[model samples]
Target: MKFKHYNQQQTVLLPYSFDDLIPEQHPVRVVDYVVESINIQPLLKAYSKEGNPGYHPKMLLKVMLYAYMTNVYSSRKIELALRENINFMWLTSMTIVDHNTINRFRSNKLKDSFKEIFKQVVLMLASEGLITLKQIYTDGTKIEAQAGRYTFVWGKSIKTNKAKMLTQLEDLWNYAQSIDNDDNPDPEPTQFKEINKEVIEQTVAKIDAKLSGNEKASSKSKAKLRYIKNNFVANLEKYEQQEAILAERNSYSKTDTEATFMRMKEDHMRNGQLKPAYNTQISTENQIIVHYTIHQNPTDTKTLKPHLENFEKTFGKETLQQLKEITADAGYGSEENYDYLQEKELTAYVKYNTFDKEQDKNYQKKNKPFSKENLYYNQEEDYYVCPMGQKMHKTHQSKRTTEAGHTQSLSHYQAKNCESCPLRGQCFKAKGNRSIERNHNLERHKQRTRELLLSETGIQKRKQRTADVEPVFAQLKHNNGFRRFSLKGLEKVELEFGLMALGHNLRKKIAA
Candidate 1:
């Protein structure tokens, strides 16, 4: 078959401008709207100088925020996009900016400046009646930090590892010397033999220098160096294994000692490697994150009160007063948390056990004749009534004040009461009598539990907590590929967490 083509010249023209592609009322427009609405002019006046040649703070802010909203985290990517992508061009008004400028704006200028801006957006939404602000959910999810688990070399572990290395090095050296003197020694020994000889020699020298018994350097300093070297060697091996596994798995895994392992709840056990991570807490109202922070703590229990206080600070006390309820999962539940919510006059729906039904059933079956709920309390007498209907006398009442000045009233019951009860075998497995201790704030806990069970609004609000917060974490870990952090130290990790929360909020805004 033969095909003939006629030579023809055709010119095609594209008419749409970058601005035309972006809607006038897009969330990116809200960036300008918020700046104008809050009158950032005063802040601009305070920082701007007539002779200075700096990018307008507002312009830089808009570009950075727009980039964050779209998940373009790297400043280099944002800089390249500004000259190439239409949407970014529209956001930056077609300005030719460099990566350094964008990076400095995000890392230095906006870190402090944008905090106030985030707060203002919360207030604006509250004022417009878009946010109820009557209730909030507090929760934390682990995000990988830039630091690695190996970065933290425990002093004890370091000493142990160094001793082990020295022992191995000595043995290898002795073995090499033995092999060299053997009758069957090859003119050229295997590479393993040569490598082991070199390693043993080098390691012995390093160990001797480190343990030179020098008086100039403190023992602590010497120990620290030894520990650091041990950690470096271990980390190098770890990285090699991690690289092999990642290559086999065909995925990117961070190698920095400071890099932490963070995965979404669903992907947590994906690779069977538990990594050091940071817990990021977000306080949300009406589906928007009002306050956020990053903690070095691995568990959710310790993060509750801090984030609540942060939320109050971000929205002000008056605004926080309107928040009547706080919701969280069982991970945040504890006697201390119960007291904290009670002291703040805030109702909470934090479940003590996420799988209570199954757990209760298993516990009941495991210990027959007496279940946990069978233990009865006699409120009037300030004592417990045994299953056999015996009245247990109060052994003692102790009072103590916490550092926060909250008074605790504790009462312990007599052991003799269980000794005489017919159901004593079922109630007390111990040889001595059973004792019951009750907190003064027990009533507050009872009230809160009742409210959580009975209030429709409370139940509905609590149901939304997991849906709202978990999805944010899922997107961060799975979609955006933020399984671990790229920075080190608590403060830097916190800054990255704030940026992530900001990214999530921006996505919510854009989707809305």
Candidate 2:
């Protein structure tokens, strides 16, 4: 028994063309077709005319998009595929692009222009009836950054160090004053809270001069002063710079400063491990990712408004004007988000934190009897009737501003007396009469949301949301192994995920 025909040095008379080598209905054909149909004028303008001949942006984009669609993320692996993989060779028309060129095109040339390409593809999908932009399911998942786990800079630690330094500086200043015995004050800095390099230098000079020839000052004190002048001052500057980089974020990675430390859901050991990650918020319609935004904030609540705003910015005002429904999980159902959704005139199917608990029979029977939801509100009298039938009148009203700067008006209500009430122990655990702060607007929104979510159309939308958007993440993170980003900074990460999203849509189109 032997093989049909085999020769080590055999050469065919005519080499097989790529078109003959590739299949007719391959996914590469879909990727190539989609890339060719989208507008690339923004990408073309990113190139300069002064360079030596370069690879066409369209060709490079086709190769990169197909590479990502097939789960080949590394530039070197893509380069190898261009050399060896028939589909890649066919996609690029047999043009061999090195890894460096591929990386430069992805990182530099595509940095400012990738969104345009992504938008064009999404619009094409929308036009083809593959996805509907009128309704969207939005959700967020934390994707780990390329930064190291331990390379973290926390804002709290910076503030603590700065506070300690300020205390030490104040002690040194008092020590200098004690030794000098001069009634006149040194003219430098009295407050160390807003210290700068110049203030530090001036204060250090005055302290050093005051302690120069003073016999009362101990050598240890002198050494401490010198340490503050040399090391502490430099550290203070470093801390200030870190604080500036950490604006509005609790912690950021030193390797990738824009990546915040967030507890990811992908932990294998089940222990909550905080790693540098970006909160990737995406809007999907018909299982296709229409828009995605990378955020440094970890929680999904604060990201909704910005995510929708970014969607509007990416697609255009007309798309937002025509948007009919918005659906998200409980994490995005904040007062601010609900208000924003109402202001935009879009029907919201978002669930609040206690929406499920409100639905539970046991929870409603056992735990929610005395909850704010169960209490009877008299809009005419501006009061609430507690479980004990006591009137809780509106005592005052105030405003609350969230970290995102959205202000909410809260009405404070208090029961007249609870000392002699029979249900005092069950009513509340507080010392004084029970009181509750209520946001009327939020309560109204929650009431409307409950009606919507419990309705027929809302139930179907909720079910579709779970099926439509979640599998995209499941395919991307688990099946495709895209849990961790390959780029360092936020902008590059956005560009990389744009490629991933675009690839996902193209692959879905092929499957369709």
Candidate 3:
């Protein structure tokens, strides 16, 4: 057979819209369909009545979301795709959108509506039966922020520095008064609160005028005055802000002050150097991120309550009240969490401190009766019998308080005759006697937790929670290369995570 000849410069007239350029079954079609279905009123609310015409929110949201789905997070890259990529051109209708506009829409216009929009998508998934909505699995990972690794500030460090600076301020105040021959008592602590950047500047100016005119002030006094003026007074606002963050947070980043300095596992040097990051918590079902929130807390313990609470609130009480079970790792094991789930009457497979050790027989045997698991307690008499046949009598009841001032009941128990017991070497480490403090309510709740954790259905759910949630994070970070956040501050950080989750969900929807 003869081959067809091709012309070097052949041009044919063909009529086809951008829609025809992208197939009907393409992923862009799914994005377009979903974008068309959702209510864009929230996005439109950001625009004024009329000035110059701008890109529609639906087109912008579609492009932004599609960009995230394809792992193109940068605005400039998205802008280039909008112009160069035919699929993006088809989805965005070939509209030219600048990178600044794209960034603004993501970091500004879409910030407030991130949760609402994400909730809509999740609710849609729930309605479509993609997510069960009956069970929720929450896990947190530290995502580095768009701040320098060295720009870290701990709240404790600020308080220590502040105290030293305050003492120096007092010393300088005394020296200044002595130099002026005014022997009035230095300003009180209450008066110190009134001293601001302006006050310090005025005081420094007065001292400088006196020193220049008379030159009798000591070099030490002049240096101290200059030091406080240059450093303390200049950065008073920043110091106050840092102290405020430190008062509430353990550690904060200097560049992005709201970002807490957390040790991320993806350290290149393997030394666990602190990076400014946000602790991002996400609840997943069927490998789709259903809900997510940013927390400053470095650990996952405190995030559970608020995460679940926000989950319920986002979907509404009636919609989420049916959710009766939650599964999480041992990182979220705490009495406060267990009690909260109990109070809400929701089933929780939340582990406690010793939950993992209790699972292993060898570990259990190593710390039996002393482990609280091996202690045999009499329900009627309310006393525990040690493995050595010694009765641990309840000595007293006391209230133990947490940092948040929340109180819990603790029963102090003393093992009778531990001083002369044969197993004292193995059991009792204390000199005189062995004492145990138990939170009676917490222990009872833990017993119930342990039973559920060991049950057939519970075991399956536990496995499913790990299987469902972990890969979502792994894919988000490793596959998509989303190890670090491209934004700064909590709000912007939240918005970026929201978009990523939404994109990931949309991709899942497409695959389905």
The number of the candidate with the highest TM-score is: 2
- Give RMSD to native, each candidate: 11.5, 2.1, 4.0
lDDT tens digits, residue span 311-357, model 3: 87788887677887888888887778888888887898877778887
C-alpha lDDT values of all predictions: 0.63, 0.89, 0.81
Shift of residue 335 alpha carbon in model 3, Å? 1.4
> What TM-score, to 2 decimals, does candidate 2 have?
0.95
Which stretches of model 1 miss by more than 4 angstroms?
1-17, 21-27, 41-52, 155-272, 358-373, 397-409, 417-424, 443-447
For candidate 1, give the lDDT: 0.63
* C-alpha TM-score for every candidate: 0.69, 0.95, 0.87
lDDT of 2 at 379: 96
Residues 1-512 of candidate 1: C-alpha lDDT, one tens digit per residue: 87886556644497557667888877777766665577455336436466768877777777766776667777789889889987777766788799998766666665555566777766776776656788777777777655544444333443454456555555443434443434663322222232233454465454445345644445654554555446646644554455554332222324443333444444445765556566688877656776788764455776787877877776688877888877788787666778888778887777765334534676656645454344567667666666666666788889876543446788777555455667776666777777766674754575566567447875676668867666766777678877766556555566666666666666665566
By TM-score, how accurate is candidate 3?
A: 0.87
lDDT for each residue of candidate 2 in 240-277, tens digit (9 for 90 to 100): 88989998889999999999999988885578989999
Predicted model with the maximum lDDT: 2
Angstrom error of the Cα, residue 158, model 1: value is: 7.6
